[model samples]
Target chain A: MKISNKKQTLAFLKKHFIMQLATSYKDKPAVAVMLYAVDNNFNIYFATHKDSQKSQNLLKNPNASLSIWEHHSALIQASGVVSVVKDAKEQSKIMDRLADAATEDESFWPPVFRIKGDEYIIFKISLSWARILDLEQDTIRQKDTPFTELNFK
Target chain B: MSETKKALIILNDSDPVLGRVCKNKFKKQAGWDTILSSTYDEAIKIIVQKKPGFLITDIILKNSVKDGLDLLKFIRESDDKDIAKMPVIVFTDLGQEPDKKRAFDLGANEYLVKTELRIADVIKRIEKFIS
Candidate 1:
């Protein structure tokens, strides 16, 4: 799907609900799977504990990159900053939409979802640029070895 | 805890197949081997003794520390300086911003989402530090 705006892009993400969150400092990169759910404003949010590394990182550095896509049709990739949510009302709404994803029987479910208190980090991406590439059309030309030319910021 | 190698490696996943696959791929460029520990305490012991080239730990350490993040804190506070430089190469299913920043903040050498790379790809990455 071609993304004309952030709303369209996030709409694509809402369909899949799974995303890879990439955060970095200096030269190192960190990636994690997130059960990403979008808000009315196309803002992305996910549940996480207060003690999580991602939370601490957000404290030190707010800038982040979030990629949400499916292999079947398209890939949704975007970069932005992450903010921690302290509001209880906001947290509850995002959690309810992701009821199925938060369950125990899923393939990639996180146990932290079962815990309470509704602590989480709401990642809002101010993407410099984004690309929604279809798998069939986007044949990666740089596929020599798996990690080759694979650069992360 | 005692370790024969310069680095200490830890993994939370108890799958037997994964341990073997990681070991086989690492044997070449690593020169040393990944020590399999299901818990954080066992990981600490090996780290104290072997002092291997590096620590390729999993994000969540089983039985002992709740997560690899805690074990990371343990290594930083250890008596040995070698353990300090022992770059943590996180090869886990857990990959996210906060965890990544925490790993880097805690001084991980590198962090790779397992879904992003295979055993062979990970071994190639380790070779960079070794060389």
Candidate 2:
């Protein structure tokens, strides 16, 4: 598929449920595989326990990067400032979106929902910049630059 | 009669007029009922009991040991998931970057500087979230 524009990018994001999130604090970096939801504005949302390393890192430093990829098909790399979505209404909305994006198997449920005692914090990554690599189209070899930059700022 | 959602306003006693005006404006413009609290402790109690649909609070509270930021932290850390996740808007006179950062860091949904924005602008910002 020709994922060139904002609409196409949003479509691509909505089709995927999992992403690799990268966070850092005090020169130390950490990455976690997370189930995420993307909104119309292309902001990414995910929930993690407050005590988790990524959450601790984000609390101290909100800057982060994330990537979503499919085997030999396409790749999206983006970075943004993360903020906790504290509003109850907004949190519920994001959870609904996440539920929709979850795997289709009826018996499967994300582990985030199964954990009972830990408090989960919903974080929003308001994308400042993004780029797409359309491998199926082989734009990298044919074009001068492989990355099609997306501007959300 | 149709049910009206409630918006809790946490303010200090220094300016009763501001709180009253905001209450009336929110009610008239957004059709939301208003609940007012004067301190962090009072706000927390009202939050647990009333479960208001929205919250607007000031950073400083007169005659109260704890201020709005403490209240915000409490709400975000509440054992009850619903209260912990409740929408909170910090409407205050503190416009400094550090203060704003602190509020957002503590999980405030919106931070409005009282001196920077007009009352109408504040109401509009609140309506955007609740509406």
- Evaluate all candidate structures by whole-model CA lDDT and list the values in order: 0.61, 0.80
TM-score of each: 0.42, 0.51
lDDT for residue B31 in candidate 1, whole number 0-100: 49
Q: What is the TM-score of chain A alone in each candidate?
A: 0.68, 0.89
The C-alpha stretches of model 1 lying farther than 4 A from their native spots are: A1-153, B1-7, B28-31
lDDT of 1: 0.61
Candidate 2 regions off by >4 Å? A103-108, A113-117, A138-143, B1-131
Candidate 2 clashes between residue pairs 3 or more apart in a chain or in different chains: none
Which tens-of-lDDT digit does each residue in A1-153 have in candidate 2? 667889999998988889999999998999998889888988999988788889999999999999999876679999999999999888767755665555333333455533433466889999999999877764446655657898888
